[model samples]
Target: MENGKLDTRALIQTGVFTALYVVVLAVFGQLGALIPILQVMGPFYIPMVCGIPFMLFAARVRAFGQITIMGILAGALVFLTGQSWVVLALAVVLAPAADLIARAGRYRRFPLTLAAYVVFSEMLIGMVVPLFFMRGDFIARISQRHDDAWVNALVNLTPTWMFWVMIAMIAAGAAIGALLGRTLVAKHFRPAGLVT
Candidate 1:
């Protein structure tokens, strides 16, 4: 709080990971388009493996505002890319939560860092939460570009009842991703001086 600025290294690392998050999200988005099920299922699985850069940022950039800034940049990029901004909303919540989790570990605790990434992964479920409350609007919005058949398929595929299933998947995916990230941090990032 004294400086109100991230160190040069932290700033650069945040930019790198923020961009990484966007690129990974974009690739998964294409997969989502090719496989509609990915829209519902991708979050739980994708972050678990793809969050290497994120977990590295989490470990290395322990500045007070680092995670929040990185999250904002990532969210803005997602919105610019035309994905729903709902993930941005979730990032606001998840960023600080991740900070708290990392703080609990004293910033270098591997388990706690992994836990933080799990929180990062949780943001994916937020993408689907709108489906429960704004089903009609979502249908209407999608229908603008997509036909009735596709819209109907999406609606039927992601009913409110399935929200629970999606939540479970998100949790499972987060746990797996966190574990894998921990391994990566220990094996590569730590040795490479990327994470402390």
Candidate 2:
């Protein structure tokens, strides 16, 4: 009976954390619109901040399923709250990928795994999704606006440079998330007995 009670409490906590993640994403989405370029820039770090609590919760509770569910819920809530449905859909898809990468970290391999999380999350949510949703003419227009220099620069870089850049940004974001998560877990979650 005691074990059952603990399980119930943990579940409730998980739900609350998931809701919190959604709220954070919604808030960030509003920020993203106010600064669309920041959304594309790859190092905005908002998603990383949002993922921290969930990462810690996953580590302590060993509940990757709950974390993944929370990511989906976060994406959905962000969409329902007036974010673009296309981006929200991407978020729903990418959040699970991020959760998988984080879970694979097993609370360690911080650098590599977190990098994967960031890259995958950003590419899916930032680049590829936008590529599809945005009109080709818009991309061309932007390319022309830059005097073709931007596209030329990309063309000049190594074939995988774009991919690596995305990965690097993800790594940066994950590092930020990990640091903030540590602080938050220590300051609030630990004191509250919510995490180890």
Steric clashes per prediction: 1, 1
Instruction: Give candidate 2's error at residue 1 in angstroms.
Output: 17
What digit string (tens of lDDT, one per residue) describes model 2 on residues 11-52? Answer: 676688777766665566556434445544534466577657
Which residue runs does candidate 2 get wrong by more than 4 Å? 1-10, 41-43, 84-120, 123-128, 131-133, 136-168
lDDT of 2 at 67: 48
The residue pairs that clash in candidate 2, if any, are 118-170
Please report, in order, the local distance difference test score of every candidate based on alpha carbons.
0.72, 0.56
Question: In order, what is each prediction's RMSD in angstroms?
Answer: 2.9, 6.4
The residue ranges of model 1 lying beyond 4 angstroms of the native Cα positions read 1-5, 191-193
TM-score of each: 0.85, 0.60
Mark the 10 consecutive residues where model 1 has the least summed lDDT.
1-10
